[model samples]
Target: MGSIVLTHLKSAWHVDQAILDDEEKIVVLRFGKTTDAAVMAMDEHLSKIADRVQNFASIYVVDNKEVPDFNAMYELYDACTVMFFFRNKHILVDCGTGNNNKINFSIADKQDLIDIIEVVYRGARKGKGLVVSPKDYATQMKY
Candidate 1:
């Protein structure tokens, strides 16, 4: 039940504020509907790292259907999409999956998700807009 502990952003304004307010931690936003299987799986991984990564990352879940404010802007049409933000700027990751904007597929393992978050945190802290993922997700991701 990681989803139980994760905060949900129901409005675009709240989502925007979350990214802007966190100066030290990387704002991780999971954009998707709670009812989707992929979204549920991703939320599980997010919840697992909620406490462990709190010092460097802040996680939030946004129901795209409920908000719909960022759907068009962020191109959040996938079953589950995760985006990283630092200092109100969108951080990109080179996942070796062509799509660097966000992790569109559900990561089955918790450690893998944690590793990715760590990479983003380190890169963002260094003033890098994009960083390479530690592991190649092209093979691991099928969606």
Candidate 2:
């Protein structure tokens, strides 16, 4: 249900424009296929918080197979990858997952996702290229 509502970047140009054009809000892009389970799960979390974070972030999902333009550049090799951008600059978060380049896993909790986006928004507004995630994914106890 959530995945059905989130906006998707269908082309390479749309993907570039989404990052390049949105000047005020952080552009959050989820790279993967909508048909994939992990990507759909991530989209659920994202869409759940879409309205809540609209003041500072704009969420968009892109199908890697369809766009394919940013896959190699961003090293998108996971089932689902969530990336952030601010003022046309890529925003990196230290999720403690060894890979700060992008969130390469499905965040189980939506609050966890909100925390990350808030951290990114605050840090990017201050002109910081990278920011530490609120919770360390590497250390969080799994249920």
Candidate 3:
């Protein structure tokens, strides 16, 4: 239900404009199949926190099938990928997952996603292209 309400980027032009139009706040793009379970989970988490982080971030969902323009450039081959951009510059987050490009997995916790957005927002405002996540995904214990 949470995933259903989030904004979706319909075309390559909309995606490009989304990245180019935002002068402030982090542009969070989730690129993947909207029907996939993982993507749905991530989208749910994103939607829940969209308003909480609106001042610092903007979340947009882009269907991989609809916009393949960034697949190769961003290496978005995973089931669900979340990337960040600030002032038209790509913002990388060190999630301790060994991959700093984009979040390629589903994050279930809304607070966890919020923390990450906060970190990314702070780093972006500081003129840093990359920032360390509040929690280390690589070291977090999984059940």
The candidate that wins on lDDT is 1
Count clashing residue pairs per candidate: 0, 0, 0
Model 3 bad stretches (over 4 Å): 139-143
lDDT of each: 0.91, 0.88, 0.88
**Model 2 lDDT per residue over 1-143, tens place:** 68777888899999889999999899999998778888878888899999899999999999998888888899978788899999999999998888888888668787889889999999999999999998888964321
Model 3 weakest 10-residue run by lDDT: 134-143
Error of 1 at 110 (Å): 1.2
Sort by TM-score, top down from the best: 1, 2, 3
**Candidate with best TM-score:** 1
Task: Tell me the deviation in Å of residue 105 in model 2.
Answer: 1.3
Off by over 4 Å in 2: 139-143
Summarize candidate 1's per-residue lDDT along 1-143 as a digit string, tens digits.
56999999989999999999999999999999898888888888899888989999999999999999998899988888999999999999999999999989768777888899999999999999999999888876544
Ranking by lDDT: 1, 3, 2
lDDT, model 3, position 49: 93
Worst 10-residue lDDT window for candidate 1 reads 134-143
lDDT of 2: 0.88
* lDDT of residue 123 for candidate 2: 98
